[model samples]
Target chain A: MLKVLKYSFYDLSRSRWTYAYLLFFLLLTFGLLNFSHDLSKTIISLMNVVLILTPLIGTLFGALYYYNSKEFIDLLLALPLPRRSIFLGKYLGLSLSLSASFVIGILAPMLLFGILSTGLVLNLVILMSTGVLLTFIFTAIAFLVSIRFEHPIRGFGAAIFIWLFLAVIYDGILLLILIWFEHYPLDHFALLMTLFNPVDLSRVLIMLQLDISALMGYTGAVFRKFLGTSLGMSIAYATLLTWIIVPVFAFLWLARRKDF
Target chain B: MIVRDLYKSYRKHQVLKGVSLGLDPGRITAVLGPNGSGKTTLIKCMLGMVIGQQGEISANGKNIGHDYLYRKDIGYLPQIARFPENLKVRELVSMVKDLRNQPANYEELVSRFGLGPFMQKPLRNLSGGTRQKVNILLAFMFDSRYYILDEPTAGLDPLSLQRFKEMLLNEKQKGKAVLMTTHMVHLAEEMADEVVFLLEGKVYFHGGVQELKDTYDGMNLEAAIANILSLQEHA
Candidate 1:
């Protein structure tokens, strides 16, 4: 398993695509911070760009990697290593690489932006968490998709469709749903939906923390109540963890059953 | 090994229909057939890489798909010779040995295959023939008991092909079971102990290579195959 993980990272490091992504994010944050010295401005800018972009790109790129590396995966399978170990090894490796980028990429910019204050610390923590959460969540999703789709283009198409639905269309549909249920008490239901969708929840939590939850529409306050308290935040964290785990186990199940 | 009434279909098109065959050690077998004749499918069934509709494949005194220990001693080189892009030749060789549950001098394997000159090169950077050489080396490096090499000499040069044949014969000397598929009749004519001719998802013939050659009078092995296939087609 350690061998698998080590080789997985080694393979990942060889790709100029991954290197480009890391540099793009790092430079984007660095340049954005220079544009604004205010800590909140920097945090929001980073959050908006990373939250909307990283998951889809990460999921697509990760899925692409899985498909393109079929030869390697088959080689791994040919060895005496258990399917679970190989699958988990690659998953852990991908997580670490993306997580390192998320942490270090944002940290460098935060330090240079003169972030030596309490608010800066909070903003940095929040920003870093969002990046890792995005990476892990999409990695889980990507792993499952990659195992399921044998064709690389098809997997990419499916990933984009899924990202579009989760990131955009789902929100529109939920808005109409909330409007239809305006006469009834749907705050709990609204909170449940937010928990189910981590992307919306992450953005909503950050907005509420910045004391601007009202702009998130009526569903924001309901989510704030469920995600604002210490316990609420912990529950939100657990939900994010579930987002990462559900797909992880699903991918493992598929990997084990996959003929490759 | 035993495959009892095996069946496999891709969506609505049935590729394998109630095919059954038995295999044993110390014999070199050839799955000879044209394209889409289900020869590869049969190999996949034996490896449990493809799930059949209704069948049980057993190998080495244990039921196939249920006994992984049987596979622990098997070395498989897939139909296509592919490796992880950007992997050094030595790294790929080392990875296979590691998976085979042992460690060996990977550089030795590389040097033996004349891959030392390209040792640090990436897989994608290598030529098709070189990649095929790498695949062959990895399959035979660990000294497996059961070897399934698909089109093993597809891109090999004459000298390398001769070396590979010698290597296969060495495995035969160890009493290992080798099931190889090939389009080159000459290699099969030279290396195989048994010829299992596959046609339209079924085993039309399974016997020693001499038995196949001597089946039809006054015809060479290739001519005999053409005659037998034409007869099958007409029948």
Candidate 2:
């Protein structure tokens, strides 16, 4: 499994898109920091971008890699290795590489700007951790989508659809439900709903950490009130961890039963 | 190796239905069938790449169910030579060797197939015949007891094809069980000690080359298979 992970990481690290992704973050972080000259505001801006962009890139890259490496994967299947190791190795390799790019891209610019000396360092840590979590969550979901659908176009479409649903549509539907039930005591309901979507949970968690009530919105306020600061952060992280694990198990289950 | 009452289906389409056969060391068995006749499926089932719903497959008197270590004893050459395009031939070979953790002496096989010139070239840059040679080298590098080659002669030049046949015969002499699928009747007639003819997901005929020829009253193995198919169509 470690050998498989090493090779996969090596393979993905050399891909042009990985470098492009890293460069995009580097430019984004440097540009935002240079203009604003405020670490907190830059983190907020970066958080919004990270929450949306990470999932999109993760889903697209994961599905593309799975489909493209399919023939090679078939060859690997013929070898004397367990099926679970092959898939889990691939998942970890992809997640780690993407997380590395995100970490390096964001950290280089921030360190140059000396944000580490400020009180905002903890906030930056939360933001980076959330970014990494989003990458793993979406990549695992994309693996599940790719293995479930044999056709590349269908798999690609499904992955994008999932990202859109979680990153965009799910929030919209939750907002509609909140508006419809405005009269009821809905704080607990809202917090529970936020836990279901990793994107919303991450947004709320970071907003609470930043303690910016105006930007917290209703879901974030509910999260803060229901669980407080430290407890809310821990629970949100746990939810994100669950999000990563469930889809990975689903991917392995589907891969084991799938016909090569 | 023995297979008994193996059955497999994709959706509503059945590929293998109650197929059974045995493969022995020091002999080669050619799995012959028309298109979509479950030839590849059988090979995959034996390799445990595809799971058959109802069957028992045992290698050397041990059940293959829920076990993967037995695959180390089998060398498989897929029908298509698909590889990581970015990896050079040498790197891919070493990667597989590392994955299997087996000591392999591929230097002679590499030179025998004249693959030395293309060793540093990425797999995607090589021609089809060259890639097939790489596939053959990968399969033969490990000194395994069993081999499953699917369309091993595809895209090979006459010289390489001759070399490939000699290599298989050499392996046979060293007591390896080889199960291959091919459309080349001449290769089968020249090499196979037994023939398993599949039609509609079942074994329609299983015996030696001359026995198949005598039973069908045909001049050669090719004519015999053709006659069997035509007779089935007419019947």
Candidate 3:
């Protein structure tokens, strides 16, 4: 498995798109820092971009990587390696590479501006960890979708729809539900809904840390009132970890029964 | 290797039904069939690439059911020579060697196939024949007990094809089991000690090459196969 991971990492490192993704972050961070001297405002801005873009890239890249490496996978299937190793190795390799890009891209510019001395360092850490967690979660979902659907376009379509559902549409539906049930005491309901979508949970998490009560919305407030700040943050992080783990195990199971 | 009572299907279409055969060492057995006749499915079943609905595929008297370690003793060349496009020939070779953790006689095979020039070239940049050469090189690199090749002669120039045939013969001389599928009847006639003809997911014929030729028309293997299909058509 480690050997597979090493080679997969090597292969992805050489791809031009990996560098392009890294460079995009580098430029975005630098541009955001240059435009705004306030570090808190910059972290919030980066958070918005990170929440949306990381899942998108993770979905597209995960599906595309599976479709592209299919032939190579056939080669691997004929070897002595187990299916678990081939698939889990690929998932970890992809997540690590994308996480590395996000981390390096975001950290380099912040370090250049000397963020270590500021109290905003903790906020930056939360933002970066959420980005990494989101990358792992969505990449795992993409792998599960791709492995299930043999057609590349179908796989890609399903994967993107999942990201869309989790990152955007789910929240929209939750909003409609909240408005419809506004008269009732819906605190627990809203908090449970937030836990269902990693994207929203991450947004609430970062907003709570930044002490931006306005953007935290009703669910984030419920999160704070019921669980307090530290406990709420811990629960959110644990749920995000669950998000990453469930899909990975699901895909590995599917890979074993797969025909290819 | 022995395959007994093999059955496979894709959705509503059954590809292999009650197909069975035995492959012997020290000889080359050719799996010949028309398109969509489940020839590839049978080979894939043995390699455990495609799972069979109901069957038993055993290598060295042990059932190869969800067990991958047995594959180390088998070398396989898939029908398509597609690979990770970004990987250079050398890297791909080494990657396979690393994954299997087996010593490979790759240098000799690379030189024999004249692939030395393309060692540093990415797989996407290589010509179809060059890719096929790489496929063959990988299949024959390790000293495995069995060889399963699908369309092994595709896109090969005459010299390279001759070299590949020589390699197969050498492997056979070392008492390795070889199961290959091909459309080229002449190649099958010249190389296969026994031929297994598949039609509509069944082994219609399994016997010595000369016996197959003699049973149909006392002519070449191609005409013999043509006669069998025509007879099935009339029936």
Candidate 4:
């Protein structure tokens, strides 16, 4: 498994797309810092971009890599290795590389700005951790979709739709539900809905951490009431971790029984 | 190696129906069939690439479903030669070696296939024949008890084809079980001591080449196979 992971990582590290992704982060972080000149404000701006962009890239890159390497994977399946190792290795390799890019891309700019020496360091850590978690979650979902669909076009389309539904549509529907139930005490319903979507949960977590929950409207205020303490934060992080674990296990289950 | 009561289907279409055969060392058995007759599917099931719905395949006294380590005893050449385009030929070779953790002397196979010049080139840069040669080299590099070659003669020049035949003969001489599938009847005639003919996911015939010829009342191996298919059409 480690050997497979090593080769996958080596292969991805040399690809032009990895470098392009890294460069995009660098330019975005540097541009945001230069324009805002405020650490918290810059983090807020970065959060908005990270929430949407990371999942999009993760979904597309994951599916593309799986489809492109499929023949080679068939070759590997003939080798003296377990199917679980082959698949999990590729998933870990991709996740690590993407996480490395996110970390280095944002860290380099933050260090240059001396943000580490200020009270905003915790916020920076939360923001980066959220980005990493999103990468893992979306990439695993992509792998699950790719393994289930044999055709690249179908797999690609399904993955993109998942990202769209989670990142955008889920929020719109949640808004409608909130307005429709405006007559009742809906904090619990809003919290449960946020928990269902990682994107919304991440936004609430970050906003609460930045101590700007007052601007977050009704649901955000409710999230603050529930997640204002460290225990709530821990629960949110646990839920995010569940988001990563479920899809990955589902991918492995499907891959084990799949025919090449 | 033995495969017993093998059955496989893709959705509503059955590809292999109760294929049972025993493969022996020091012999080459050619699996022959028309398109969609399940030749490759049988080989894939044996290799455990495609799981059979109901069957048992055992290699060297161990059931394949028991563990994957048994795959080390079998070397396979796929029908298509596709690889990671970004990896150089040498790197790909070494990576396979690293994965299998087996000592392999690919140097001779490389030189025999005239792949010395392309060793440093990425796989995508090589021609189809060269890639096929590379595939041949990889399959032949490691010494194993069983060799499964699917369409092994595809895209090969006459000279390289000759070399491939010699390689198979050498393996047979060393007492290795070689199972191959091909449309090249002449190659099968020259190399296969026995042939298994498949039609509509069932074994239509399995015997020595001469036996197949005599049974079908044909002049040669190709005629015998054609006769069998034509007979099926009439029936």
Candidate 4: tens digits of C-alpha lDDT, residues A1-260:
89889988998999899999999999999999998888889998999999999999999999998998886688789999999899999999999899898889999998999997789999999899999999999999999999999999999999999999999999899889888989988888989989999999998888888888889777677788889888888899999999999999999999889887
| Clash totals for all candidate models | 2, 0, 0, 0
Clashing pairs in 1: A79-B99, A80-B99
Residue A211 in candidate 4, Cα distance off native in Å: 0.5
State in Å the error of residue B78, model 1. 2.0
Among residues 3 or more apart in sequence or in different chains, the pairs in candidate 3 whose N, CA or C atoms overlap within 3 Å are none
Clashing pairs in 4: none
Judging by TM-score, tell me the better candidate of 2 and 3.
2
- Stretches of candidate 4 exceeding 4 Å from the true structure: none
Off by over 4 Å in 1: A113-119, A180-185, A214-221, B1-4, B66-69, B105-113
DockQ of predicted candidate 1:
0.44
Q: Model 1 misses residue A150 by how many Å?
A: 3.2
Per-residue lDDT tens digits for candidate 2, residues A209-228, read 78885565675566667656
Off by over 4 Å in 2: A217-221
All DockQ scores? 0.44, 0.82, 0.80, 0.83
- The DockQ-derived docking category for candidate 3 is high
How do these models rank on DockQ, best leading?
4, 2, 3, 1
